[model samples]
Target: MKTALTELVGIRHPVVQTGMGWVAGPRLVSATAEAGGLGILASATMTYDELAAAIKEVKSRTSEPFGVNLRADAEDAARRVELLITEEVRVASFALAPKKDMIARLKDNNVLVVPSVGAARHAEKVAGWGADAVIVQGGEGGGHTGGVATTLLLPSVLDAVDIPVVAAGGFFDGRGLAAALAYGAAGVAMGTRFLLTRESTVPDEIKQAYLARDLNGTVVTRKVDGMPHRVLRTELVDALESAGPVSGLARAARNAAKFRKLTGLSWRSLATEGLRMKRGGDRTWSQVLMAANTPMLLRAGLVEGDRSAGVLASGQVVGLLDDLPAVGDLIETIVADATGILRRLASE
Candidate 1:
């Protein structure tokens, strides 16, 4: 179970519970930490004050090392970085590659920078910018994902970067961990698997809905936030795919306003953030407007448990999962099973 990832983060196992927006909170994160894995708190959904309080609560629940996942392009990115430094967080995982100076600042403050990338080139870029490690997620990952499978993408990134690489996307069991290690990765990270666990904050009915899916139950569509998002094939998702652009934009605008109210952000701040998002890529103004749809829609499904009105971000691995074990039991089983498999292979 010990690997570069374990050594790098001071965790006993080379397993990570990913930062799922509504699911990864203090209780689940602390449970993962207590089980000896690196649990990441999802801060993209929280306000600054909420993040601070959640970090404090995690520290109170467990002394083991953990991480916080945030959006690098957020308006308060620098402020969040400072908070991590002041709180002495063990790891800072970014949803996007952070600026070079931001990486330097975090590293100088003794916080490890681990960004999640979807491509080999991105891994190279972040590694060159002084990231301690990178988590390479493939197309099968939940939420926004690329088109490459992990079996192909993981090696491409491993070849492109010298830093430790954690394989993500489509990983759920110890056999997957063994396979990832065999492929030269330091470890594996799981989001959907962890989200189905007993400690996860997601409602039970929702968990059952995820568990009922088969391998072909998920679909990738660009209707969600103008990006390729993998989610369960729900009626809401089907409707989104069939809806016209005009209707989508109208809904997105309303959600944007609601998100602003919930987060206590002014109209000017939201407009500025939207502009920043637009400048970050080749996104059109319509795409930028649609971007506001993600947080509120996800909140409706994940936090409010209204399945008919919301969309559930899920990995294809949902089909293979059927049970909800506690976080501690899940990690222990994965590590032990992986150890046995590796040992048997060596003996052969």
Candidate 2:
């Protein structure tokens, strides 16, 4: 189970429980850490104070190494970086590639930087900027994702960067881990698989809903946030796809306001963040406003357990998952299974 990722983050297993929003809180993270895998706390959905408290809670629950996933483009990105440094977090994983100086600042403080990348060039960019490693997620990943499959995308990134690459997207079992390692990846990162675990705080009904899916149960649509997002094919998702642009924008505006209120952000600050997103991605004003819909909608489904009202972000791997094992049992099984597979191949 030992690999560059294990050595890089000081974890015993090469598996990683992704920092999934609403699901990767202290309870889930601590369980994953106790299981000897890197458990990343998802900070994108939390306020600064909440993140600090969650980090403290994780430390209280387990002393094993873990990471925090951050939104590098957020208005408080720098402040959050400082929080990680002050908290002595072992690793910092970014949803978006952070500025070079941010990478330098984190590295200087001895925090390992690992950003999720969708393409080989992005892996190279972050690697050149001193990222300790990169997690390359493919089109099958949940939420906002690219259009490339991991089988193709993983090798391209491995070829493009010398740093340790963790393969993500469409991975759920020990066999997938063995395949990723065979493909030259240091390890594997999984979001949906971890989300379906027993330690996950997601409501049992929601977990059942995810487990009820098949191979064709998920759909990738841009209606979620003006970007290609993979999610379970729910009635709400179908409605969103069929709705007109004007209606979509109206709903997005309302959600944006709600999100602002929940986060205690000023209207001016929200607008500024929207503008930054627009400029950075060359997105339309409508698309920028639509982007605001993600957090609130996800919160409704994941946190509030409103299946009819909220959209569930999910990877297509949901079809293959049926049981909810405890985090410790899941990781132990994956490690043992992968070891047997690799050893058998070597003996052959």
Give candidates' CA RMSD values in order: 1.1, 0.9
Please give, for residues 105-150, the per-residue lDDT of candidate 2 as tens digits: 9999989999999999999999999999999998998888899999
Which portions of model 1 show Cα errors greater than 4 Å? none
TM-scores of the models, in the order given: 0.98, 0.98
Candidate 2 TM-score to native: 0.98
**Which residue runs does candidate 2 get wrong by more than 4 Å?**
none
lDDT of 2 at 155: 94
How high is the lDDT of residue 286 in model 2?
88
**Tens-digit per-residue lDDT, 107-176, candidate 1:** 9999999999989999999999999999999999899899999999999999999999999999999999
